[model samples]
Target chain A: MEITINQTPFKLPQGASIAEAIEIFGAEPPYAIALNLTFVHRQRYGETFLTQGDALEIVQPVAGG
Target chain B: MSLPENPDPLVLYGTSFPSRLLLGTAQYPSPEVLRQAVEVSGPSFLTVSLRRQAAGHNETGGQAFWDLLSTLKIPFLPNTAGCHTPEEVWTTAQMAREVFETPWIKLELIGDDYTLQPDTLEMVGVAERLLKDGFKVLPYCTEDLVLCRRLVDIGCEAIMPWAAPIGTGRGALNPYALRLLRERLTVPMLIDAGIGRPSHACEVMEWGFDGVLLNTAVAKAADPIRLAGAFKKAIEAGREAFLGGAMTQRETAAASTPILGTPFWHQNPS
Candidate 1:
């Protein structure tokens, strides 16, 4: 299956969970996930499944005024 | 001589802070400068934002930035900077809460791209939802009386209105409206943007505003550390002045010296 993380396309095995996608995308700590614009709690990362063409946003803290 | 430290602290959402200034973590020359500035300024809160993970640049400077923030130990007020609609604000705010581990969110719903003015019409609705979601929302809005009133009516404990457009440093473009908002709303009001100098922060603080949030002025200065200290003192002075109460304006001149005690009065023509 194919999914977009931070708008970058990635190929993962079918039935891949969000945790697997995080592993492939190389996410760092102090980050949060939103699956298709909905926040996904950290506890549910393993159970959440992604479909083809799903948009996943991995957002991290940055400097802002 | 400096006035005694204000015993009255700036309270927001039932939390009291010794300092009224809220500093931003962005645009400092370097992390070291940011650290020094934060230390010197001693702001009550530090504003931050969340951005999409930069693709391929995993070694990006985010780690160091986060590290610095963690070390500061100040409370974080994560903002929804670039969101245009309520949904975007919602998602961004949710992510911010999880990442920052704070319920405080600076709600910024931009209605225009050029001015970066918040969508006042949309802000009330967004704020209502965030408040219901258990987020302590600090909405960034324009200096409009009705808009501010609506926000307060909708359960916002504090409101952050721009002094001018973001990054403009123009400083309180509409003093009349801002003053009216201050007079009308009992909630804490903070001048969030368009503050260019320490005097700008002082002016708004003198208006009885609860606090000021600024970045570009200090961060872009030749010496961010010095400017940060300056802002800190200015805020304290202004708060003290406000608490001390100011004299009313007068058109006629009033002499400070005692008229009867003037030695040269006899020499003046009668």
Candidate 2:
């Protein structure tokens, strides 16, 4: 199945979890994940499975005013 | 009534901070300069935002910046700078809380792209929801009295009103409205955005604002580190001046030297 990470398209194996997506995305530490505009807790990454075309945001600290 | 014995520390939502200046971690010349600026200023809080970890961009995607911020040990005040709606603010704030592990949020909802003004109409509702979610929300709003009153009514502990448009460095554009907001609302008010110089920060601080938050003023300076120190001093000076009480203004000029002691002093007949 293909899912989007940070709005970028990527192909993952069927039933791939958010944790797997994070690993695939190679996101750095001190980041947070939001699945379809909902916050996915860190511990729920493994149990939460991603379906086709699901949007996930891997966000990290950036400079802001 | 006499002022509190110890009012030096600026208080917001039951938390006390020694410094009244909050710095933004953006637009610094370099990471090293930012670090030094943080050290010199000793800001009460440092503002940060969250962004996507784009492909092949991890090198500058904030891990190193995070590492640097961690060592500095300043409390983080994550902002939802670009969100335009309640849902966007809600999601962005949740992500910020998860990443920064702090309940404090600088809620920013941009209504206009050109001026980057806060959508005063929608912000009250957004702030209410965030407050219900157990977050300490500091709303970035205009100098409008009614809007700020509504925000306070919705349980915002502190309010941040723009001194001018974001990044323009124009300073407080509406003194009358800002002063009215200051007088009407008892909550802590911080002048955020549109601050170009230390004097700009000082001017608002002298108006009894609780603090000042800025990114461009110090970050864009030719000497950001030195400018940070200057801001720190200016903030303190302004606060002190406000507390010490300034003389009243009058149309007639008052002589400092006593007329009796002046050698060439003469009274003019009306």
| Best lDDT among the predictions, by candidate number | 1
lDDT of 2 at B261: 73
Q: Estimate the TM-score for candidate 2.
A: 0.94
Residue B169 of model 2 has an lDDT of: 91
TM-score of each: 0.95, 0.94
Chain A TM-score, candidate 1? 0.97
lDDT of 2 by residue, B1-270 (tens): 965655579899999987899999988888889889999999999999999876555433477878888999999999998998888899999989999999999999999999999998899998999999999999999998899999998899899999999999988899888888888989999999999999999889888898999899999999999999999999988899889877778999888877777664566555
Candidate fnat values, all: 0.74, 0.85
Q: After best superposition, candidate 2 residue B243: deviation in angstroms?
A: 0.8
All DockQ scores: 0.75, 0.81
Could you give the interface RMSD of candidate 2 in angstroms? 1.2
Best by DockQ: 2
